[model samples]
Every structure is written in structure tokens, then in C-alpha cells.
Target: MNQLKLTVSILATAGLLFFIAACAQMGTLPSLPASHPEALAIGQQVNCAECHEDQQKGTLKPYKAFNHSPVFVKSHRFYAASDDRLCSTCHKSSFCNDCHTNKVQIKPSTKFGNRPDREMQHRGNFMTMHKIEGKLDPASCYRCHGRANNERCIQCHR
Candidate 1:
């Protein structure tokens, strides 16, 4: 009976320690700030590696992951979709809205004409490319033009 009581006490103590540790971890949970501390220069390309050498604090993704290399500029959608919370820390929703939203008044290629380093859709002779691209991945076209600008597309497609 004494051995049984000791075993029960040990189990109870172990469970209590685990619960406390979990609660402590929860109390000190890591979270990102709502915005960057300082305003970044307009049109000045940032090099994150210059300032930050370590991986991101809460998440272990490398700081270089945020760099706007041509590869990153082209494939940013996948990264954004994976964790837009990380993107929001550095960029305002309006930054993405400029391209992704229906409110865009000017074409992205025209608006970012000065920023040749940044990739924009329909950059050069898209009419020729779209014929091939549309056949390869019609869903890609539908993402932008399906509901919003189908009228413009139907004018040509139909």
C-alpha cells in the first residue's frame, strides 16, 4: 500500500510539473509586432542581410527568405500564402493591395516601370505569351480575370 501511494504521488508530481511547464510556455508565447519600428525609404531596396544575420525570432526562416531577389519576387505568392503574418510585419496590406486588389487603377507593369528589379505581370509582349501560358495553366488567368475582368477577356476569347 505504501509503494502504491509513492507511485501515485510520483505520477501526480510529474503531471503537475508538465502542466506548469506548458502554462509557463503559453504565458511567454512568441508573437510578432504589428508593424516595423521605423519607416523604410520609398523605392530604396532593402537588404535584410546587412542588418539581420540570424534567422527570424519566432519562426526559424532565414532573414534572406525576405530578400527581394528575382526568384523571390517571382515566387512570393507561395511564401505569402504560407505565412502572410510574417509579411505583414514589414509590409502594409496596401502594398500587396496595389497589385492584388481590384482597386488598382494602373497596370502593375506601368506603375512599377521605374522598378525594373521587381517583377510585374504582363511585362513584355504578354499577348504572345498568354496564348501559351493560358493553355498551360488556365487557372492562373482565372485567379485574376475570372470574376473581376472577365468582360475584357471575353471580348477577345469569345
Candidate 2:
């Protein structure tokens, strides 16, 4: 009975110590802010490096990763997929949904035409260009056209 009581007391003390350590560690963990401290201009191009040359706090990636350069914009899908928590800092979920939804209501080319940096697959004169592009990369065409606008492609692709 004494041995069991000692074991129980040790376990209770160990649990209390673990709980205290966890509470102390919680304060050291990184946390994201609700919103940016500064207001960004609407529709203006964002260059994270312009303001933050160093690595952003609480994020694994450097500010350069978030820059809106042509290369970054063109390959944003990969970056966004890898760690979208960093993306939520500056952009709303809707910002990505605008361009990435399965059934695109408005072609990005039309919706964000003013922003030429964005790479829209079927931009101006796509009808004329698709024949050559399709031959080069048929998979790209099938990805979106396979389901979204099957009727249009079926008329000719079949």
C-alpha cells in the first residue's frame, strides 16, 4: 500500500511539472497576427522585399518567396500549395479562389486583364494559338477542358 501511494504521488508530481512546462512553452510558440500592421494600396503590385528584405518572423520562407515577380506569379501554385499559411498573411482565401476554382466563372485574363504579370493559360487569340500549344502540351489542355468546358473541346478534339 505504501509503495502504491508513493508511485501515485510521483506520477501526480510529474504530471503537474509537465503541465507547467507546456504552459510555459505555449508562450514561446509562434503565432500569426490577425492582419498586417500597414494598409496596402488596392490593386497595386506588392513587393514584399521592398519592405522586408530579411526573413519574415514566424515563417520559414524569406520575403523574396512572397515577391510578386513574374516568375513567382507564374509558379505561385506550387508555393501556395506548399505553405499557404504564409499566404494568408497578405491575401484572403478568396484571393486564391478568384483564379483557382474548378469552374472559373470569369477567365482570369478578363477579370485581371490590367495585371499583365499574371499568366492566364488561354489569353488573347487562344483559338489561334491552342492548336500549336495543344500539340506541344496536350495534358495542359485536358486538365481544364476535360471537365469544365467539355462541350467546346468535344466538338473538335474528338
List candidate 1 stretches off by more than 4 Å: 1-27, 102-105, 124-129, 143-149
Which ten residues in a row are the worst by lDDT in model 1?
A: 143-152
lDDT of each: 0.75, 0.75
* Alpha carbon lDDT at 70, candidate 1: 65
Give the Å shift of residue 141 in candidate 2: 4.6
Best TM-score among the predictions, by candidate number: 1
Tell me the lDDT of model 2 at 139: 75
Q: What range of 10 consecutive residues in model 2 has the weakest lDDT sum?
A: 142-151
Per-model TM-score, in order, reads 0.64, 0.62
